[model samples]
Target: MNGHFPWLTVMAAVPFAGALAVAVLPAAKRTLAKNLALLVTLVELVLAIIVTVKFSPDGDRFQMTESYAWIKSFGVHWSLGVDGIGVVLILLTAVLMPILILASWHDADGPQVRMDGTAGESAAPRSTHAFFALMLAVEAMVVVSFAATDVFVFYIFFEAMLIPMYFLIGGFGGAQRSYAAVKFLLYNLLGGLVMLAAVVGLYVTTADHDLAGPGQGTFDLARIAQAVSTGELHISPGAEKAMFLGFMFAFAIKAPLWPFHTWLPDTMTEATPGVAVLVTAMVDKVGTFAMLRFCLELFPNASKTFAPLVITLAVIGIIYGALLAVGQTDIKRLIAYTSISHFGFIIMGIFALTSQGHSGATLYMVNHGFSTAALLLIAGFMITRRGSKTIADFGGVQKVAPVLAGTFLVAGLATLSLPGLAPFVSEFLVLVGTFSRYQAAGIVATVGIILAALYVLVLYQRTMTGPVKAGVEKMRDLNVRELVVVAPLLALLLVLGVYPKPILDVVNPAVDDTLSQVEKTDPKPAHPIQAPVEQAAAVTPLGGNK
Candidate 1:
């Protein structure tokens, strides 16, 4: 890599470059395209790891920053950087891309099965190279979304990703993919439009500040955060509330929480497993990420004012998502609902406004991405073998495919927040953090956790523990390659569950800095949220997982 050139920019460009390569290659050279795509993803992952290692965790400021002039007249420029939060998310995006590629290998080896009631009829693999290429392209955009420092630049990458993801789901998904793709686009674009208005509002405000202050107007978030910290920019509670809702609506729809969450089940059920992984695990996190990066940091007073409502909604989502999941017969749809429920917990932690709460939220984002990826990948593998995503279509799979059953069990247990799994630590932190702030919400969220155990365990029993369904008795164990693909994810789930400190050490400083900024601007009232005795006692020992 060139020392002066921006490595992250190179990471973004490499996938598009690969996509071009894939497009130009002869159709007969599909294998070549596949290899090239894998190489590109591997390179991207390496770049992310390099960025992580090089990041200065000691400094809460953005690292490996690149800035340049773009639209000088509007005071907008291309700027990108990463702090600890960005590092893990960027790395998570990188990690999933390769796993996705590996998950698709079996699909590439075979053909699409026609739905003419034929069980094993084969058609040519569904343009496996193109699928991988599009996935990499989406990964690149995800990286950009996480790394961009300027609001305009962030908006560009944030919105541009839909183009590729839309096609990926629509072109390569199962039945109803087209409808899912359109729904996804409409809902996200609606949110984006609102956020775009906010971005414009921000620019206007910045200009006004520049006229009165010593420096020029800028969209640099660091400058904006500093301005807020020093009271250079004063947004009234009313204006702050509106801006907060604008950003909140956008992220909520993306996070697909509660009322804004109708699109998720449809998209997940219809899209291919690989695409679903990104939609749920990676892209969706951007919404929560934005809430933390922009909503809380930029409009702390509004967040505090809105905290009670947000926590109430979050609790409702937790219960509602779980109930919906339990009612769903479609396996994919069930998982999608479970995600909504889990995300509710994440948002609750964020709005709880405690240090551990934020830490839990951050860790939840990371753990949820990995754990969800593992489940979706395995789900894809099962669907490919059994040719159905309905829970009724599976039974006693452990007898027929022990290895597949094992992976599913591991993923499902993680989903249930089993102790010593990645989610367990994060979820515990969230509840503890929430209990510290809002005892009632925390206690209710714990009920959601218990429900999680129900749905997940029931799902596992229904799918893997009964007598093998008539059509499923002959299903084969995972192939060598599939095992290789899932092994790393499974290992990490256990490793991080047991020892999350390394990741936390890096994440805590940035989280602390962000909360500190919020406090200085919107000082905590003398009376913080009061917790019930039992709930307070429950979370006291954890100390917010810090």
Candidate 2:
């Protein structure tokens, strides 16, 4: 797969090319731009499926790899590859793009006037071409980030993605969109700066150790990780810990873990639902994925050293986010808080240092993407119809729009990790995995589940169950297009929930490899189980046992 064809490059290039084409289309050709973008995404989806089918889970750790020299001076290369984890995430990105494009068809068509009769600075009629183009650009960057095997290549796209997302939020969002956009940019830029220092530090360390050659340095992730694992590239414990902190700081902000998470709710609250989904479901995932790919593999000793602290932060975020969600009155903000909690579970699982934890964290990323997309997109539709983001603005929505309410309920249930929904299986694995290693943290995290049910059911009851509010009388059911968006997401949630083996089969081997890189093994039980014959003998009377 590596030498045969440039599969990963083509996968990323198609969307990038489509974005440029869409961006340059004339204003009058909005429909043409939209359709072109959708077609590009669909093609990307097909390519992703082909890659997945061709990827052998039992085969090499990284398949479909492509590499070329880009910056030979610093030992940089234009490299790309995919393991099971990368393939699934790429698939997730592809599946969401066209659907989000459809959901956002009219989002940029006109200005959004405020209640005060004044359109804000950002409320001018936006270019529909730019909106869809930015989305495609985001898809391109995210896909590249997932497939990139070069540390420098990953860093470039990881930071480059902010440009499109900033425009998506500020240029096409709510009254306070500018503030949200700036906050989002500044927060991420700060993290990227810290990570830049770490990236430089890593190259310096490699040069000092002469891992690549007598004097050359390398930014190839696989090459460096191999050296680290074989003990050929020895970084001092203190330096490794510092570099790990630098990388972890950026990822935590991107993961938007607590203390660093203040930016997410505001960004989600201000941006359109589709853009919000891109941020949380797609962009943010690169953070946690990098934790597995870079932090653990490249600095195994440091990863183990920091696992306890990271898990503690994760537990706090879980309870903290759920508690805040219970109190939010804005529908979008509430959902944003819930994402923080879900991310907490993901981070916890990753640091739990077991195969189950790693697999669950990986699967949770995919499941959360679909579940959050379904919920946020449906909420966007509701907000559009009602002209309010406040939860109290609508009541008995089910009375007039039964289908919308029903679907909303389903999405909400999935968010709370209800059984038979995609998120449940992942959340259960996170807990089971965490409990096996860190029992107290796992117990505290379960409180998030209880709090999750509280917020979701309360949100539903208040908005859907009461008598119809004054302005809700003319509300309509989900039209054909809206149903198209919601139906597949709901179907995936159901199908994945009942049978997660397909995803697990792909993820487990990768998990094992990660554990091996970190030199971790699952802990043995304190109380060992007796053999079948021993148990039978113990249960039988002395004479009857013979």
Candidate 3:
């Protein structure tokens, strides 16, 4: 927490070190690489916990902040900090990494089963070393992206995440791995390019100001936001809105809103379970997070102008994703579509522009990660065992693997936001907050809950219930190691469901700060009026009172 310790820098570096080590290790030392990566992630998790403890609930300023001049000529600095929301997300990034690594124990080092039922014949047999190394690299980039306080720094960290993940899909994914990876890469790259233009525009605008004087501009996010919040910085309204759209366009693509979401299912379907969980559950969150941090905070006026369109899209995504999920035969692809549906809810919560909605969206991020992890990992277990990822390939799995079926049921229930589960609390908050502002959108999004139930339960019933399928009679239940792997995630889902106050305490303050930054409030209802009979009659100018 202290500047003296530089924990933020250290935390980000640990995974990089692990990745470099794994990258250099001999091909035979796959165990060493995996173990080292695990050790590094464990350490990162501890540091994330410590960082969380250091953050005060009442504080609005970024905590554990560090700053130093890095590129002096460009006016860029190495700056990082964690607000309550950032810390929780950083914790999520760290927590999910180890769980993913553990779950990928056997899968990472083996050939992935493609859509056609053939094991991928990559240049190498299963290479755990490369897999773990890339995983660690992805973790490092994600951490910095969450913590970055410099605009250019944040953008760089933001785009840097794509490298390790690109290889993760292309090198160790399904039969169509290369295509999926290319699609994911190209989409993200386009978003980044637009954002880069915006970043450059911001610098130029800042430099032209009298305060900046001459040619000195800065890429400090804090300073820029502060300038905008006060009356000092003045870009033309048109320019500001344009810049806002430029940045928003990037996040929208990243958020994979509506038509932008096509690449996600393909990429997720082609990815391994670990990769899918990392990208969809954790990494994709950056989109929403940046929208809150950058789009709303830096462009309050533009956010107001675009709120209606964004909410409309969020509603569309909610329904579209759910309907697609319902029709999916591929289980992994189904998981991807389900996420798109859930993300709609998350986006709606954010733009709802209510404190309750903002806080709920934040909590939804954490809850969705845990829920998705359970679904993906457990489903992966079944697919790996059955030699297929198709839902039709599974039936009556509970008859053979009762424990697995039961766990899947719990995960499915959580996904649908069943009462007494973590997602229910967050999803409820999102709905309540959204309804507080936009009644019609809230009502429409509510239908997604029912669609969610139908998809989740139907998937469960089709795959886990009924008579045992011909080749699946001998499918094994979750073993002891598997239980160990999932127990923590399940426990979290339950504990947070019952006791979300601890997280809310942290998230609420950040939400309040965000609402303050945007400076918008829910519309007030008109007061009902009652008048004397004579006064009422006088008011009826058009016709005489009966």
Candidate 4:
């Protein structure tokens, strides 16, 4: 599959082509545009599944590889490949795109209705074609980002994605959409600028040191990572640290860790739920994923040097996000804060630098995407019904709409990482892995779990448990279309929660490879387990000797 077929290229290109086609469709063909976009995503999803099926976890570190010389002068190539991490994330993106399209079916149509159920005549019209087309464009860019083995290629799309997303937020969002969209764009653009400097610095360093070969340089991630691993490329500690900071600053803001996280709540608060899902669940994942692929692999020594500081920041984010979530009066804002907390766990696991940690972090990324989608999309539906995003606007939702309230409860419980839910397995693995080496940090991170319970349960109680609010009296249950969007997500949560081995099988080998690249090994247990024969022999011998 490496060169026989252009799987990765096709996967990215289909949606890009679809986006073009959808964007150009006549405004009169709005439904056709939506159908065409959904069809394209479904086709993309099928291709992704084929790639996943063909992927051999035990085979090469990067499979389905495709490379062609794109810019000879710059020593750049259009290279695409996927390790286990990329495979799962790509699949996650493919799965979510269609669901989001369906979830946002009517989101871009006309102006929003007022809380009194009156249509707002003053609101601006939204273009459905642009909305769906922008979403498809985002999918294409994200797929490319995941599969790109050329650092230059990756950076190009990484920054390019912000364009479509800016429009998606500002064009199809709420009252403060313009403000939120600007803030999101500015924050990420600043991060991208910083990353561009580091990208250039890396290319220069490779050229100066001849990391590729004598009198040559390369921007291929695999080649450079191999050079670093084998000691063929020796970057000075100071230069590596500086480059690491440059790359890290960008990803941190993308990951939205603690202080850098200010833009997210505002962004999600204003964006349509589908756009919110795209930003938080799928788009933001690129940041954390880059940390694993770029930061750790490309700068292993710097990774080791800065692991503690990174872990500390992650722990703080966990606590900070959870605490804010507990206090949020706005439903969307609350979910946004919880995502910040979840990302903290993901980042902490990545920096923990062990097999379990890495594996859990990767799995957590996938699980969080689905869980967040389920919760946020459902909340969006509720908000549409009540014409409000305030937590206090609805009460006794379960009494009026049992199915909706039930699903919301399940999604909320998953958010709290309750036992027997999708997030629980990933979160547990993260703690176990982090506790193995960074005990104090792990211990503090658990406070997030307690806080998560407080927020999730309190939210459920306030909205769904008490007597019905005045407006919620006639609230409807999950409609067929809405159920189509949510059922799969919830099913995945349940399936993965009890049996995470399938995903683990795919990610574990990659995690091991990453640990090897960084020269990390899991910490040994304090008390080793003895073989049964040894234990029996010791017990009998002790009795006889006594």
Candidate 5:
């Protein structure tokens, strides 16, 4: 936006610094740690907002870039920058952090005595510091992962994110924390390893190609993109598809689309709601984000070659996830399945390769985060009251806590693409865009919306309606603290639902740029040929009386 500024670097580092501060501060001083973490994230949010405000969508794809030599042996650079796409996603990451900190305040720092029964008061805060710290650390990784202009740099951040989230579940979750944490870690770790293999291939391939009239290709994505743009570097069809599949495998698992989604419901169900929100709303976004940023950008031919297969999987994930969600008894698990369904739409939009679809996919990432945050946080509140995530455990909740029920319902409606809600706008654009290319895929995917309404309304009906269940009469309405946590998200959804132009104005340009990189467009529909003597010459229908 201006002269060389390290704003991107600062935005990424602030969270890490905050985590370090939390780690070194007296563990017993829980309030200090919480306050410090909150302050750090707030400051990061402020910086992110400032940078976003300064970001002119019409400007260069990468803005406020910062580059430095790193691991020069193979020609890597610690480069950072943001296009409109990266800027918005970075904003999503920053925006969610402060809210999550607020949400976790009670859950992570509540009045629970130590299980060991030794200095219970202090232990609650001390243990929770790790939770907050890890969250912030994950935020830092997300910022860098999105903003990194270097391919290798992105890979580092990509794998780096799993560490904090791994501990967040295993360290401070439910009775099955260890099992859930291991499963989550193992799945992501394996995906990362596969991605690493691809990264290594690119490293060697770029080197051998002697790109840029030079000895070896650099890891800077900008440079590689430039080489390809100018026709200086060429990839064989086989190599392109191999690398594409490598990247796709990792992202698909992360997006947890269809078959790759088994780890998700388990992780979301076992994770604390705060962690669940972080993982589902933000972390899972990395999958689709990488698809747009790397897979398509770097391997355009392979992307086109595999578009049909990918779209089929996306459509399948949509229907499959929605169906499973409708049958889920656990509310948290249900929400997780819903995200898998939503991700199907996001991926479908991206592969549609239409300007509108990619734009909607980008916006979907932001809207999905907000809507998911509202649902998970409100669900968190409900679970805290009932001490259960089972849908059957709740009934007549709206009578006892009107505000909670209302907010939860609004969030659920948004998830189901209710009009006048944030998600509806993006979801609409995605379908409109996809229909232009493949009507059948778009139509099949739309079926998921009906299933979405079924699952959400049914969950609401089961949990918040009917006579107050046993002990539900005592459940309190949303307190100011809880209201504070969800209000901003609702406000965002409402404003965006009404006027998404501000985001789209920025998003469309990036989408166009991405489509250009992929060198693909929506194939026009076929028009049947007409004959001069059409009526008499045309083939008659099977049952027609000739």
Candidate 6:
């Protein structure tokens, strides 16, 4: 069933097809476009599921690869493949796309939520189709960003994403939509430009190594990875460091790591609830994805050299984001801040460069996507009912809307990496791996877990446990439709936590492959600094070695 057609290609094409169909239709037929988009997303999800089932975990490399000449003269190709790591993320993206579309279905219905807790009516703007179109576009771009094997293709998909997202925010977002859109675009553009410079540098360096002048050089990531691994390619330490920073800066900003993360709260605050879910829960993941794919795999030596600095920033972000989250009054904004803190754990795990760390980071990305989506979606519904995003505006939501409250608790538990939730296993693995390799950094990162518990529990207590606030008293529980949308995420959060072997079986091999490459391109020192320092004083007291 899988081999008959290029399922991956079809999956990539579905949304584009939907977009084109929607674009040509008259504004009167916007509903058709929206329906088509929903269909396309469902189809993509099914394809992803099939791909997942058929994927061979034993393969240990990219599978179902599809390659063709894109720009032959300069060695640019349209290549797509998914390793175990990429496959899960792709599946995550696919799964979320349909759910988000469903979640957003009510946005364009009409602006008329009654104070009596009745469903509201929105203005009959053509925005329903427009918003869905942009989401599909973003979905396509994000999938490509994950699946692309060519650096140039990856870069284009990476940057092309901002356009749809900008429109999603600016066109369909809240009152401050324009401001949020501009800020989101500008910050991401800056990072993209930096990444562009690094991408060009990679090709230039590769060209010189291959002795192919100008555009004659190739930009195949696998070929380059092999070259760098085998010493067939030589990138100077300074160049490596510069390129690494360029890529890291871009990804870190996208990951919204601490200082570079200011754009997130503003963007989330101004975005439609659905758009907020996609951006915070999904799009931001591309940054961490890039970190694992490019920074560690392509420039291992630089990654190793910069590990201490990266780890420092990660820990600071963990604490800083948590502090900021605790201070946030807006529920959406608080979740955005919490995402920054969670990403810190992911970045810490990646830089830790251990098998468990990398594997955990992969799983964390998947788990966070589901958890964030669940939380944001629930929050969105709450806002729709109450007409406010401020936590202080409502209370005793559990008493009024027990189903919504329960979902919130489930999602929050996952966010905090509770022991029985999906993120728990990944977060624990990350910490364990980090402790094994960088004890101090690992220990500091544990504080992030504590902070996560604090934020998630506090958020729940504020919104759900208090006495029913004036406006929230009559709110209804989640309807069957909403429950249908969130049910899978909750089930997976528990199922994966209980039995992670399914994902780990596939992910560990890829992590091992990446670590092997990292070791080759950037071998560890005979004695890591921390290991020696700990033993140094003891050895000195023993009069040194004989």
Q: What does the lDDT read for residue 92 in candidate 4?
A: 96
- In candidate 2, which residue pairs clash? none
TM-score sort, best first = 2, 4, 3, 5, 1, 6
Error of 6 at 326 (Å): 1.3
**Which is superior by TM-score, 2 or 3?**
2
TM-score of each: 0.91, 0.97, 0.94, 0.97, 0.93, 0.91
Question: For residues 107-172, what per-residue lDDT tens digits would candidate 2 score against the true structure?
Answer: 888775453435767755678999999999999999999999999999999999999999999888
Q: State the TM-score for model 5.
A: 0.93
Per-residue accuracy of model 5 over 193-243 as CA lDDT, tens digit each: 998999988878788877634667678787777666666668889988999
Taken over the whole model, the C-alpha lDDT of each candidate is 0.84, 0.93, 0.88, 0.93, 0.88, 0.84
Note the residue pairs that clash in candidate 6.
110-121, 110-122, 111-121, 111-122, 112-120, 112-121, 113-120
Candidate 4 or 1, higher TM-score: 4
Off by over 4 Å in 1: 1-5, 106-126, 211-216, 520-546
Candidate 6 lDDT, 387-419, residue by residue in tens? 888889988999989889999999999988999
- Worst window of 10 by summed lDDT in candidate 5: 111-120
Residue 529, model 5: lDDT of 58
lDDT winner between candidates 5 and 6 = 5
Candidate 1 vs candidate 2, lDDT winner = 2
Better of 4 and 5 by TM-score: 4
Clashing pairs in 5: none
Clashes of 2: 0
**326-369, model 1: which lDDT tens digit per residue?**
88899899999999999999999888888788889999999998
Deviation from native of the Cα of residue 126 in model 6, angstroms: 4.6
